[model samples]
Target: MADDAARYLLGIDVGNTVIKAVLFDLEGRQVGSHAIDGQSTRPEPGHVERDLEELWRNASEAFRRCVADAGIEPGQIVAAGCAGHGNGLYLLDGDDRPLVGIQSLDTRAAALAEELAAEHGAALHAATLQEPWPSQTPVLLSWMRRHRPEVLEQAGTLVMCKDYITFKLTGRKVSDISDMSGAGLLRMPECGYDDELLALYGLQGLGHLLPDLIDPTDVAGTVTAEAAAATGLAEGMPVVGGLFDVIASALGSGVVEAGATSIIAGTWSVNQYVSSEPVIDRDLLMVSAFGPDRFMIMDNSATSASHLEWYVREFVERGGHHDDPFGFCHRRLAEVEPRLDDPYFHPFLYGSRLGAEHRAGFNGVAGWHGEGHLIRAVFEGVVFEHRRHVERLRAAGAVIDHATLSGGGARSEVWAQMLADCLGVPISVADGEETGALGAALSAGVGVGVFAGYEEAVSGMTRIRREFEPDPDMWAHYDHRYSTSRDLAEALQGFWSSQYRDARRENNGEEEAK
Candidate 1:
């Protein structure tokens, strides 16, 4: 007879800050969870890389700890699944050894992104339904072709971060559809590699570098003896190819249904919506791979908790030491009245790639204004930025009646409520903090036939903890502020673009002289 816990599954999520591993039973209850801090190396400006060997070692430790905490033997686990950050590029040599794994935050490929978009023209847009971004694979590949040609020449395969780890574990070089779809190389909606697109980028025959496209619920491969020995997993345990981290978070938040939207509030806040087809708007929004047969259409702002952290570190440094900074910020924000008498703020402290250029400062910081007002301005600024994303989605014909909020920032009731008010929509906090891991597990469950379909797996595993409905009075105030924010953002876009171009030219001239 099979023991109840023997049918357990393991889920691993590789995030920017941490690699979290969770053990779940067949019924979807978390038996145990463990986390390991992930280290990132930035050798130069606009570059971020992770040591592959170090990542594997840390993941192994986390896996062993989670398994031990669950009180389950290695052989007892029936299956495993993995998820990780998306968009970055990973180069593997002929023998499938990782040479480099660049992170999405790295902006070294910006010029290449623009070059490819210009060269490919309509073909690129028709394929991906979105223009190449600095983080896209094609741009990264082009960067490599010019800067690191040797690596590209000797490369046998190219994989994303998650796919590389999956290959290391299962010895299978396959990419799940969701992750592949985000690669700029794959044709969106069709979900396959485009040869002409690759050729246009001077990457002809590079299609061979990509793995077979499998559905997120597909059984990618089984653990081998080497993987079992390294990670303490049972040999032959099935491994499911999970979706990209963003898509997994969406699934784990139970926002898989069409018309549903989710705000992933981590280091960056990504506003995602499920649509029956692709929603591609170059001016304001973008689209990404959501699931095996689904699409995600929305806007992604590269700032969220990172902005909050910056405020706490720079302005409220001492306040963070005495008590929880988030809690303190929340309480302080609550004390400040909603109407600050036409005081405006721009939340682009880091100078957004798509938004306003001003730093976090009040238009009117009079002696009468106190610390509470300053803190409230910060919170209101972030929320207002999110509201702009919501408005962009609405303009793209998306119906975002509600959104599930998931991330470190979502823990604050005050912030969540502020978002609810700013967006004029209900916001639900996700039930689990580890939605990425849960989504990976749910995908595995579907792959292994433990669940009948994606809907069933999601229904059994994901849940919403609480919902925050929009306050009509506060929404009215935010609606007016949002209009002002948009006007300010648009007015400053050209100025930012000119500055960026001038800086790039100066830097290029210096490099040539060197």
Candidate 2:
């Protein structure tokens, strides 16, 4: 008889700061997991990057630790899959050496994004179902081509975060339709490479940089001897094409069917739903879904729990609260007394959907407030931003009666409840914390025929751990707060524009004058 370990699969989730390797049984039960934090460096203002070598090291260590924790032979693992944050540029030089590793939090291309949107907004939207955004892969590539032409001169294949991990594991330069389409590198609806899109980005003749496009479940390659030695995995283990992290999270949250929404409150605010047809009435972020002939209508931005993370790292950790800083935040939030006069915050530390010039701040702060009020405002601000994305989806005809919540925010009962109350809909949290990893593992299972397809895999593996219903009492309060926040954001747009322009002029004097 086959041993229990024989049915195990491995999944890797690569986020901006954390790399997780998790093992799951055929039934989707998480058998073992390990997470390692990676450092992001800000070499210049608005530039967020990582070391590719460091990322691979962290991933390999995570895999080794996870397999050991699971107490299973690496040979028993059937296949592996990776899911990573989407829309950042990962490049290998002409000689196949790590070049630049820009993360999705980058805003260096904000000015360029604005320029492109103004000049070719309609064309871009028509082709890719997306508008030029600061951290978009194509936009960033264009920036590199213009400002740092030497980088592209030596560039080799372009890949996403998960694809980088996949390449490292299997020695294959490949990406899936979900990530390439999500990165605005492909024409929408049909989901294929379009030279026109690259030309529009001024990246003409660089088509060779794009990796081979494959289905998410396609077996891209297998673990080589080098990778197996580094990661402690079996030498012939299969590696699937992998997935965009948000799509993986959706699958992990049991949102394979149309009309089901998945809200990932991670470093980015990702609100999306699967649709049989793509929505083109309005300019919205969308990508080809994992399932055939489906589209994931999205309204995502860099505004999300990242703001809270910054606050915690800067203020809370600096004050000597080391153990469970988030727990400390939850306790403080519990102390806050909801009042109409409470201060509100703008969760735009990264970029905002409203405009590229938008920045984050706390509004209406008074001497009378305390830490709890600030923390509560931070929580509310994050949820309010997610609400903005969900509203955009709703405007694009997404029927969101309910949603599955995942990511770091879902772990916090306070934030999850706030989200449910603010959105005025039922929010369900999945059983596992590492939903992205679980989603990648599902693809692995599908690749190896352990499950026929995503629907069957989701049905067999995922379960809602808890559900939050909208509290009718809090509805009016959140509505009022959201309105006030929206108006405040609109009121400050001029100020943001002027301030950002001035800052830019100071940083790049001759360029701004030109």
TM-score each candidate: 0.90, 0.97
Global lDDT scores for all candidate models: 0.76, 0.89
lDDT of 2 by residue, 1-514 (tens): 2564367989899999899999999888999899999999997778899999999999999999999999988988999999999988899997778999999999889889989988998898889888889899999999998888877899998989888888888889999998988898888778789888899888899999999999999999999999999999999999999899999999998888988999999999999998888888544766555647777888888888888899999999996757889988989889978887899999988868887788899998899999999999999999999998888888877778999999989998888899999999999999998899999999999999988998998998898999999899999999999999999999999999998888677657744553
Q: Candidate 1 lDDT (Cα, whole model)?
A: 0.76
* Residue pairs with backbone overlap in model 1: none
Report the lDDT tens digits of candidate 1 across residue range 155-234: 88887777766786799988887777766667777777778778876777777888877888889999889988888888
**Model 2 clash pairs?**
none
